[model samples]
Target: MLEDVFRDQWGRVLATLVGILGDIELAEDAAQEAFALASERWPRDGEPDNPTAWLITTARNRAIDRLRRDRTLARKTEQMGRELRDRPEDTMDDTTKLPDERLELLFACCHPALALEAQVALTLRTLGGLSTDDVAAAFLVPFETMSKRLSRAKRKIRAAGIPFAVPPAHVLPERLDAVLAVIYLVFNQGWGAGRVDLATEAIRLGQVLATLMPDESEVLALLALMLLNDSRRHARMRDDEIVLLDDQDRSLWNEQQIADGRSLLERATALRGSGPYVLQAAIADLHIRQPRDWEQIALLYGELGRITRSPVVELNRAIAVGEIAGPDAALELLEALDLGDYRYFHSTRADVLRRLGRDDEARLAYGRALELTAAGPEQRFLAMRVAELLPPGDRE
Candidate 1:
């Protein structure tokens, strides 16, 4: 019941109140008051026929009463009360009708006027339904700092009168990228399907977005991508240590998810509306579905390179090109890429050199990767990979 209440009604309750309160902070306070009231009375009332309606109505009345008693807000109180009363009572429905409101809140939180930090905080708070402390912990920041950022963001949204609506269709292409990022961020929280221990609030957020916009290609792509990546989670680690992709047992991957991912990729590309998430999904699909063939993978990565122009994509393309064209050709491509700042680039280059039997170059590349990586799991994995290539029984 708690999960359903939060998943279906929290955003709508917040949005409805925000519309009336004209203040995000006040709206949140009132909505929370409604939630508290539900906690106390729902068990006794045995769940109302329309729980959301009850919450919204109760919250609206609470906000009106509070404002009526505040001299400073008397005019705004009357105005907001009229607005709330005029809104249809039947606006509340089952969770099915609430995704659009949640998506609108996501966009409002990410409005350009908010600082990037505030945007992240507000996204987690309002859309992700996380506490400020949880958000702070996720980012490794102090809770007080996150609280301040969230407070400022909500205040700014009210003060600036940011429209709580989706961007115009003409601007959807650009805006969609931000939306996809937030969804992906949400998905990563509980994305490791096999590892129930890896759950996070991000997963709940992803489920909310998926429920809200199931037809959105980017949403599908993000969900597919996460499922595919997570499908390999068992193979990604062994005995509490990370395993490199090349060395992991492919048989352990979840075949069902791979199939779903493949189908989603086809749909993502069918309309030819290619975005970064779709392109990345295609890349992940290549890795999991067609392990034996890197030609198609290489070409896809090349296209992704043009689309995103991130150095990481170029490095990934080099890996595919190496598998298809030969190590020497891929080495030439890697030479032109100045991804010294990225550890994965060197690790990949090392693997390519090892495949080419260039021991000296491979050793140097491995050393470079080791020097650059901060992730302990990755560092240990690289060391093991590098050790395997050493002369048999060299006893290093």
Candidate 2:
């Protein structure tokens, strides 16, 4: 119970503290101290009636006390003290009128001035509530490296004097893409790690963004894409093994989520949103159909490829082309692309070769995929394919 509350409330409490204290490190320290206090007091006194409110009040008081004790913090304290005094503890409910500082924190983290990698790292750590270790693992970086990167990002934010507020409307479009990308990255990491909590948090944040910018078609489209993908979480794996999309039981898919996604897509289309996210969401919507329109999917991917000019999108388009035009054409398309090091590229090539009965090339491609991939389920599946390609008696 306590763990759930902490997971759900950590960002809200931390955001409130940062807003009040005007210092990230100080806010983090105070929040940690507040949680530690809760750990000690909650068991003895029973959990507070309004846990989030209690936590914010406790954390704010801690920050105020620290500021009072430290001579160096006196100026900041005085600056913030008036506003803090005006906002009473009783008004700290989850739905308090205090503008949700999380959106501000997110925008600040993804500011254009910061390096893109730093922006992603800061967003994941600060807004996603991921520990440095988890963030490092997600990005496949060493713990110490991730720690330094995070520290540097925070220092940059402080030194650069980046305001803790959302970007102006004229600049919102430019910055919003980075925020959306960070959220999706978080969701993808959680999906890969099988961390339901992280995935849930990402969805929650997406909903918040959508609510904050209702007319932003890409925001709605991104949320729709996530909901559509999340709807299949239950059927994506079985007994620790991957279940490919075509093989998954449709009955296991979340029908309501799919409906919601379709509705969002319709709204995006109504807004004349022809951006990459809306196109991608449109593709995902087609994939859920009983009889998928591969030609339409391929066309959408072509449109997306033109918009983004990304080789990855082209690769996806080739896959859809394979469905409509046959594996030979897909293999021809694959050979022209510069995706040698991409594991999925090799995996897709192997599938094409296997379908064409080119056992030797398929075996080599599968080996390359196995070597490149770090995912356990994918490695196991590829190994099984390799074993199948071996001679009858030579099979181990």
Candidate 3:
């Protein structure tokens, strides 16, 4: 019960506190304290009728109390406490009356002033309701590193006075790109890690973004892309093994989600959105078809790679290229790009090498990939590949 409520309300409570306190760190502290108190008391007290209002009041009061009593608090926080004390918000009981400031909070987290990594980490910690540890796992960084990064990001926001409000229409497009990137990064991390909670959270946030920016083509396209990719989740793994896309059971795929994603893609196309996300969504749409269009997929990937100049995109293009022009072409493309420390690069190269009858090289590539892979399914799959490349006696 507590976990569910925390997931549902943490963002709202934190956003409201940020609006009131004018400090991300302070807001987070207060929100956490409130939740902690809730955890302690909810079972005994039988959960509040209006949990949002209760949490907001509790967190705000806790922050204000600290600011007033803790002489060590900075003058800025002291001044904030004074201003909050003067406000009539103490008596505001209805959550419906409060403004939903998550959009503002999200935009601030994704502000161009911050580094892209910081933007992603901050947004996940705050708006996505992920723990700092959760963010670190998604980033494949140490907990200490993620903690320091979050601290630096919050300090930067405070030091630079990045406004906690959404940008105006004139600059919204440029700012929107960073927000989209952060959201997609979160989605991909969850998708790759097999954490459905994270993917579901990303889709939920995307839905909110779509509702807010109804006509934004890329926003629609991104949500469509995620849904389309997520539709195959049930079929992507089997008994601790990674199932290849072609080998996945189509019966396990979510037909409704596919339909919804296709509908969104059509809308994005109708809007004439040829942006990176739209292009990718179009590719995802093609991917789910009975006979995968490797040629068109390669062409779309080439276009995506040109726009982003990302080696990962090039790597994907190479996979489609392999289907069209054989292992030699894919191997040639892979060799030209430098994707250091990327697990999939080694795994893909291993597959291409194996297809070319280069067992020795494929075994070496699989071993490297296995060392880098952390996910249970992928790790097992890579290990199996390595064993397959060995002679029967050597395998034993």
TM-score of 3: 0.78
Model 1 — which ten-residue stretch has the worst lDDT?
191-200
Top-scoring candidate (TM-score): 1
Question: What is candidate 3's lDDT per residue for 242-340, written digit by digit as tens?
Answer: 798889999999999999999999988899898999999999999999799999999999999999999999999999999999999999999998996
Candidate 2, position 73, lDDT: 57
Which candidate number maximizes lDDT? Answer: 3
Candidate 2, residue 199: lDDT: 67
- Deviation of model 2 at 229, angstroms: 1.8
Instruction: Please tell me which model should have the higher TM-score, number 1 or number 2.
Output: 1
State candidate 1's TM-score.
Answer: 0.87
Could you tell me how far off, in angstroms, the CA of residue 308 lies in candidate 2 after the best superposition?
1.3
Ranking by lDDT: 3, 2, 1
Q: Is candidate 2 or candidate 3 better by TM-score?
A: 2
Write down the TM-score of every candidate.
0.87, 0.84, 0.78
Please report, as a residue range, the 10-residue window in candidate 3 with the lowest summed lDDT. Answer: 189-198
Sort order, TM-score high to low: 1, 2, 3
